[model samples]
Target chain A: MDITINRGDFVGLLGPSGSGKTTLIKTILGATDVYGGEVRVEGQSIAERRPRVGYVPQLETIDWNFPVTVEQVVTMGRVRRGWWYPWQRREDRLVAHEMMSRLGIADFAARHVRELSGGQKQRALLARALVSSPRLLLLDEPTSGVDIKTRDEIMHLLDELNHQDVTVIMTTHEINAVAAHLPWVVCLNGGIVDSGPPADVFTPDTLRRTYNADILVTEYMGMKLVAESPHFFGRNERGSADSSERGEHVHAASV
Target chain B: MFTPLQYEFFVRALIVATLVGGLCGLIGVYVVLRRMSYIGHGLSHAIFGGAVASYVLSVNFFLGASVWGFVSALLINLATRKRSISADAAIGIVTTSSFALGVALISRFRSFTRSFDAALFGNILGITQADVIAIAAVALLAAAALFVGYKYLLFTTFEPEVARFYGVPAGWTDAGFSLLLAAVIVVSLQVLGVTMIAAAIVIPPVVARLLTDEFARMLLLSVVIGALCGLGGLYMSFYLDISSGASVVLFSAAVFLIALSYTTLRSRLGSARWRRRSAASGKLEPFH
Candidate 1:
């Protein structure tokens, strides 16, 4: 997919389960090989822009039983020394503590990370990503297993960060989560099926093209939402909910 | 026990056991935590090939075994990283082939086979001052590497992709760790032998895992368990006239079993007590 993510833009990369969202993120981080196209950050290739990019991996990607404290995990973001030096400077510790407080996890700074809830885990990871003060932050499935309230809180946190000029590009399988909160949503299947403001690209036809399944798209309070159509479960009585029609039931509650 | 310590060889053996035990324990935490216990097993077996080759060629045992073990570790790592080969398959192939080659080579010469028993099962009782120094040197190097890279090592062990994303050089970290594991295995051969060196690299961390969820505490606990196991095993071997390597492994396994049983029993009792208290408060409910 050909795309450009500008600074301070909160773009959510939306896709189905088997889509290339993770592959794209890995490619951006230079952790995987990019077969065809070039991925540049601020006119530089991803490999060259490594220092300016921060990453918050999915919660499941970490071994929570690893026995590291919250503050220690956040302090790993500092890039001041090579791996040969394991010590964290006082300034780095201060920054990590400050980030922990900002994320509302200061109370658990010395607690084992496995003791955290899913929401707290995501916040801790976010704090780690922000501790280094990178120009661009990349998150993968930040709210996948979190509760609805926690999901909203994470989205709000991302919005607040974006407003403060830290460019963000997070990937998620939840389409309505992106459509409701993200100003820009990139629908990704094997490639970018569509990319624009939510209103421009969150249509039923666009979602079907991206997901390769019939999806219901509807409007609620001037906002677009997407969900799997009820026809998929052999209940063909209700066709795909297009934007113009309002169903009796709220088919896309995620919005 | 006091009289045995008066002998120089016994003294050297104790020093070797103490250092190698703590060293293996320190490195073993990563091995256990990363679930790379099989790699340690594979490399330990692979070291036999190098031991046999160096004996036949009249070279330094440590040099040959370290080279072979190091090469085998890197090869196993490479095979697992490939898309086709599974980790267990890679380990099975590399370790068995290397060990088989060592056996075949030794069987060709009766003179070589005569001295192979000590190398196979270990001869800690016959440890020399040179062996002590070499073990001490490798132990120090391993300690330095771990101390310098503790944070990066922990980060990469738990989350490689995240560490790579932050420019932690995860690939280099992994390669360095593998080399360190190889060196530790080689140093451990004289005390634990090729057959049981992997156990020394695995058991303590496992016991610590059962006891604590914190990494730092796990490291400290694993080191202590290893040192104690070594001292106790050596004493048992001295008194019983048995194999020190086997004794050490048995001691470690016994400790692991005790820890497992204790933790399980405590959790069960704790839960049952909670249930009784809740029942007394009339909060118990029936299942559907």
Candidate 2:
């Protein structure tokens, strides 16, 4: 909890549901109260610094029926800079167009938001959040419900952003996909259970403690992966007795 | 067949309707886009109580209604934020109670007169020169505020949390927006009456959405459509001897229906064209 994130660190918050991972990020972004501890970005408390913090919320939080185009959505980032006119500045428009093109959504710039696929929508929102040239980026479950390919694409995009020295702090349940990319990790279940490199914090003990179940860990390609035993919760009594009817045992293996 | 003296009222009604209708059209674009139509409706009805109270106290009805409407708006906003109540439920509570109180107070005064009917149903025929000036000023102020706060308002409407992270105080914007909506509702009530104001505030923007995707175009188109509806309804009322308020709302609804049908037809044709192009490109295949 007392650790410091440097100016360009790519950090991943790894935890199960009900953890304080989101609370920690919200506090860092000054969206929540930070009474006992201080959150500083570049030698200034977040409350005083007012750095541009780009936030990507969970996709389920938005009302998809909202009437907006992809380009218009991205231009919303400039709203705080006193550009309220419908016709935006040439520079802002250029930035927005470039961001959309970089995100591979240039063709969708004129399309209504509701017509977008899930991956397209996520990329559009990502472009929207990044168009203002924010120094710090926070993403909450950006890969949730997305296909594996899309998830990797989004992570790759974030990795590229991180390479450009933009600070990134993201939360995700997909530990292995992030372990290879993220340099620092914070594992939390109601509090900071562990914080260190992903390999050190994503052990079987940490996973079990975080998820409240017996977990098996395997190391492959210098990354820690977790698998939960289905019998940890016991079997049902009133169900079909056949092995096939026992419901395929759930096991998650990640690298 | 129209005499000059009688035609003056018609001309005045057309001008006043165009001014007020255009203002509502511009503001209603935001109202519908933000899903704040219920707030608009609530403010409109709550202002009724204020107008009634002012009437009973022999005060300026507009002043009473604007103050009361703003207070009611603030209370509704606070209740929605501070408590667990839903916004629709809160608005329903505030508007119904305030309007009922207004009706009760109005009942205690002298016998209900034709003026009460005129106030409830709207009387474009009796609008004074001062009324015209006041409506024009309110309309201009609303247009200017909308022009200045357009982007911030859109940002807040679509993604409030993101707007807040970028240093836009979304809550303050909401309060300011509610105050502006109150002003719109007050002016609309004076012109169209409370029972008919929601139609004027809702239909034009809904129609505009079918016509365009650009926000500026939507605003401009909605204003034109609303003014046209207002003027056309006024003329129809003058000639056909119908209720002016009802005629205006009906004309707006008619326009909305026509626009909806047109958009649907256009989209279908666009999709057909896309299908033909894709087929020619050998991208279309039959599903088994």
Best by lDDT: 1
Candidate 2: segments with Cα more than 4 A from true spot: A1-3, A33-38, A43-51, A82-86, A228-255, B1-6, B109-114, B268-288
Backbone clashes in model 1, listed as residue pairs: none
B1-288: candidate 1 lDDT, tens digit per residue: 698898887777877777787888999999988878888888888888888888888888888888888889889988988879998899999999999998988788667744566777888976777788888899889888888888889888878667877778788889899888888998888888878888998999999888987788999999999988888788778888889898888888999899999999999998788778767877754421
* Tens digit per residue, CA lDDT, model 2, A1-255: 676788888988877787877887888778886778777776788877655688888888887767788888887777666455455677787888999898899988888887788888889878878987888898888888788898889999998999999999989888766654578888788887788887787777887788787668877777777654554333544553456765677767421
Interface RMSD per candidate: 4.3, 3.8
How high is each candidate's TM-score? 0.90, 0.87
DockQ of structure 1? 0.37
Best by TM-score: 1
Q: Model 1 chain B — which ten-residue stretch has the worst lDDT?
A: B279-288
lDDT digits (tens) for residues A132-248 of candidate 1: 788899999999899999989888888888889999999987777655567888988898998988888988788888878777778878788865544354344355646445455
lDDT of each: 0.83, 0.79
Q: Which stretches of candidate 1 lie over 4 Å from their true place?
A: A47-51, A79-85, A227-255, B1-3, B109-114, B276-288
- Clashing residue pairs in candidate 2 are none
